[model samples]
Target: MPNSTLHPLASLPNLGPRTAWFLDEIGVATEADLRRLGAVDAYRRLKFQFGRQISLNALYALAGAIENRDWRSFNEEEKAQLRAKVEG
Candidate 1:
């Protein structure tokens, strides 16, 4: 159970197989890449890929993944800011 043998993206918070697929499709392949891109920018990329038809839940997932926390753990203010960014 060493970090070196980890499955990379799969080991990150909030990154279920589906979410990981979306992240991969949007060009953020690794945990390092995800952190570098940050949640907001990664969310934007995913939305752009799907023509803005993506759900807000994906944004929440990304926010959580970047912070190494659960998506539902985000505060209302954080969720509100993310929602506004998505809408704008």
Candidate 2:
């Protein structure tokens, strides 16, 4: 069971129970929070909080969730762009 008022992160694309838990741990519990933080910032927070426990794929997932698309939908170029944002 889950709370009705708070939008579940798992309800978004590319996010599952474990990922939702991870986002919650990093203070992102809803779509509004994620939207406010944006994918790059959210991924950065996750990386800072979880370090190597988080992966590059989480960045794609966050972007996909924001765009309402699948994580795999991002082409190589887009992935590279995100990689640059993360590593830059």
Question: TM-score for model 2?
Answer: 0.88
Clashes (candidate 1): 0
Clashing pairs in 1: none
Among all windows of 10 consecutive residues in model 2, the one with the lowest summed lDDT is: 1-10
> How many backbone clashes does every candidate have?
0, 0
lDDT of 1 by residue, 36-56 (tens): 998888888888888655788
Residue-wise lDDT of candidate 2 within 62-82, one digit each (tens)? 999999999999999999999
Q: List where candidate 2 sits over 4 angstroms from the true fold.
A: 1-7
Alpha-carbon lDDT, every model: 0.79, 0.89
- Candidate 2 at residue 9, lDDT? 88
Q: Which stretches of candidate 1 lie over 4 Å from their true place?
A: 1-7
Could you tell me how far off, in angstroms, the CA of residue 73 lies in candidate 2 after the best superposition? 1.1
Query: In lDDT terms, which candidate is top?
Result: 2
- Each prediction's TM-score versus the true structure: 0.78, 0.88
